[model samples]
Every structure is written in structure tokens, then in C-alpha cells.
Target: MEDKEFDKLTPEEKKARFQKAVDDYNSGFVEVDYTFRSVASIRVEEAMEDAGRVSEEFKPAQIKVIYEAAKADLNLEHYMNPKFSASHMKFIMEQEMAGKDVTWLPIGKILHRSIVDKPLTRDQIRRIKERMQRAEPKDSVIADLHEKKKEAARVPKKQGQQKKKGER
Candidate 1:
């Protein structure tokens, strides 16, 4: 409210803390989402729980499997930043999802893109199912490297080392 309007409040109204707060809120002066109570609200809670459900949606064990895939692909490595929550990372997984865009949406708006209040569409389900299925078997890249070394050892080395200049 403008200073003039605030000043016009009766001395008793100004002195009454809770009522003043309510009046500001009804006047659209207060931001409700930042309040502690918002954490338990449906949208906030969904955004919180969404961090896990997306990965667990397709396969129970695929979280680790997808991490392994990210370890192998340099292109996706940047988005694996420890600073971002898991749900934020999922939004950037594919080139189309968010690319470099960051969302300012409140949880209610974000839930539309996520599988919370509303169920995922058929195509969304199919695509996520296929993507998870395509990841390499969990923890296999290091094993593949080990196998490469084993295969190299199985081949014979040269019979003699290269001769140095007239030493013998």
C-alpha cells in the first residue's frame, strides 16, 4: 500500500500486528508462497517429492544407471552440477526439455510439466520408458574398460624390443 494509505489506518489498526498483516495480504501486499506453511502445500510438496519419482517411475534401479550414462556422455556432464536439485536436472535432461532455460514458475505451474497432480500423458510415459530402457547396464563402463585391457593382454607382443644403435 502507498504510504498515504498506510498512514490513514487508524492508530488501533496500525497497532494490531496480525490484523495489519491480514489487511496487507488481502490488499495483495504479502507474498504467501515464501511463508513456512507453503512447504506443506500441494505444489511445494510435489516439487519436493518430484526429485525422486521421475527416476523411479520407469525402473526401480535406473537412477544409478542414468548417472552412469551421464558419466559417459560429455554433453550432459554440465547439467549434473551438484548445486541443482535432482528435479531441476531432470528438466534439462533432453535438449528439448529446457535447454539453457531456467524456470521462475511457482510449484503449481511447474507441476503441470511434472507427474504430480495430473498424470503424465501417454506419449510422455512412452518416451520416459524408452529413455530409461536405453541406458547402458548399471556400472558397466568401468567393466568395459577392464575387458579392453584383458583383450589387449590376450594378443602377443613383439618377440624382441627395438635394437638401440650398435650397443651390442
Candidate 2:
């Protein structure tokens, strides 16, 4: 309603309108926005604990939203070579400080796939990248193993699969 029209109403009519709005809100007819909260309002430690306790069956989207909000509110940045988010690191730190199990959180595992403390050294990454970029045939060891299997398969299976004499 326009302010002018509302101002024209009697006090009793205004009260009735306010009551109807409240009723609509209470009845789920209105979506009351609760997203105004800031990350500063969150207790990081508590959020970590709660996240740790999240059920394994919870959807990834749910976890993502929760974590995304936490990350945004804190204005956290990614860290380390693998680019782990600050929110993830904070949660792990909180769990560690409390002596809680830090390894098995479903959300944590989803958010940080590697979950490694020490990131791979630059040399290691460089070597891996170089190896991947190489034009040589890959999997030499597996290639030999597969060749051996093919050779074995090519040989006919003798009756009873008897071992040759003196072949220990």
C-alpha cells in the first residue's frame, strides 16, 4: 500500500492491516529474509563442530551453501598451492585445536579433496606437469605387464595345466 493511502486509513484499519501482514508471515505466506546476518555473527569454532557433525547423507548443495555463506561472510581467501579455501582451513584448525578428529568430515572431504597439510613442493608439481606433458608412451610398467598377460593368453592351455618337467 502507498504511504499516502495508509496514512489516510484510521488507526483501527492500520492495526488490522499490520495484523494481517503478521498473520501471513506466521502462516508461511511470506518469505522473511534471514540472509542479512554477517559472518562476524558466526562462531567459527561452533560452525566447525556443527559441520563435523553433519550427516553423511546430507546433500552436497546444502553443504556448499553453508560453507559458501561462511566463506563469504568471513571474506576468506584461498591459501596454499592447491588453493584450499580459508573457511576450510579455519574449520580444520578449530577441529585440531579441540583435539577432535579432523580427518573424516564429509563436508570437509567434499570441500577439500586432498585435505593434505603440506602442499606438494613446486619442484614436485613441476615434475608432474613435465611428466604429463611428455610425448612418450605412458604407463611403461603397466604396458609391460599387459604385454605379459597377452602373451600368456596367446599360449594354449594344456590339459590339466601340467608344469613342465624340471621347470620348478
Candidate 3:
């Protein structure tokens, strides 16, 4: 689209246009210059920790909106390296930060199988969500310990196991 054509669009229309560009990028229509990341560039993830921090003024929902807006701004600045807005990206980041196995998330499957491609399937996503909900934020060592405690309780008591057994 020409500058004059884009200029005529209202703010909302312009946003929609940019969003389409992002969608196009995500669908692999618009190729991203991976080299740009190697160059001095601001990473969205670097700011995520601070962004996700819930201040009295800013909440998680508010941060997400801000992050999405920033993504649009980044796309405007770096058209060749547009940011792909995946709903799972933030979730993955948070989960990974808490040391959870994000492999379960069907991020391999993209969201919308549009005129372009969707990496993930809805069925896969549903399955992943179910697993996540059932696990209740499964952590690494934490999960192991929790399971061990439950199993220990089930085992038949043999000769009274003391709390802190250390012979003098």
C-alpha cells in the first residue's frame, strides 16, 4: 500500500493493517531477517520480566495490551523483522521462568490455519490445556518430591520410620 493510501486510514484501520502485516509474517508470508536479531536490537523477552511484574498500576492484562502495542510499533520500525504475536509465547515464557516443561504446549502448531499456515492444531491445543490444568503447574524437583510423598503415604508401614533418624 502506498503512503497516501495508508495515511487516509483512521488509527484503528492503521492498527488493523499493521496486524495484518504481523499475521502475514507469522504465516511465513513476510520473511523475517534473522540477522536483525544478531545486530543490536531490543528483545521483547528482556523486558517481559519487568513487564510481567504486577505493579499497582499495571496488571497482567494491561501489560499484554502494552506488549501487543509494542509489537505493532516494532513491526512498523522493522517491517522486514515483524514480531509474530503468538498467544502461547507469553505463557511459555512465564512457565519456563517458573521452571516448567513447556514442551507440552502445542506451540509447534500455529494458531490460525488461515490463507497461510497454523503450526498448531485446535485439538492439540485442547489436549495441552487439559494436561496443563491437570498437572497444576508441574515443576521439576517439586513434582518429584510431591509424588514421592504421596507414594510414601500409600506404602504399608514397616517398623515405624522415624522423622529424623541419625544414630549416635
- Predicted model with the maximum TM-score: 3
Rank all candidate structures by their lDDT, best first, as comma-separated numbers: 2, 3, 1
- The lDDT values for all models are 0.44, 0.47, 0.46
Relative to the unseen true structure, what is the C-alpha lDDT of residue 36 in candidate 2, on a scale of 0 to 100?
A: 29
lDDT of 3 by residue, 63-163 (tens): 45445534543321111111322443343344444554444433323432111123334454466665555555457888878877987999988897567
Once fitted onto the true fold, the runs of candidate 3 whose alpha carbons sit more than 4 angstroms away are 1-41, 44-85, 103-118, 136-168
In model 3, state the lDDT of residue 111.
32
The number of clashing residue pairs in each candidate reads 0, 0, 4
Error of 1 at 65 (Å): 28
Candidate 1 clashes between residue pairs 3 or more apart in a chain or in different chains: none
RMSD of 2: 15.9
Q: State the displacement of the C-alpha of residue 156, model 3, in Å, after optimal TM-score superposition.
A: 39
Better of 1 and 2 by TM-score: 2
Residues 33-122 of candidate 2 have per-residue lDDT tens digits of 633233322433345455454323334543453454444443222221123333445544444445444444223212322333444455
Q: Whose lDDT is greatest here?
A: 2
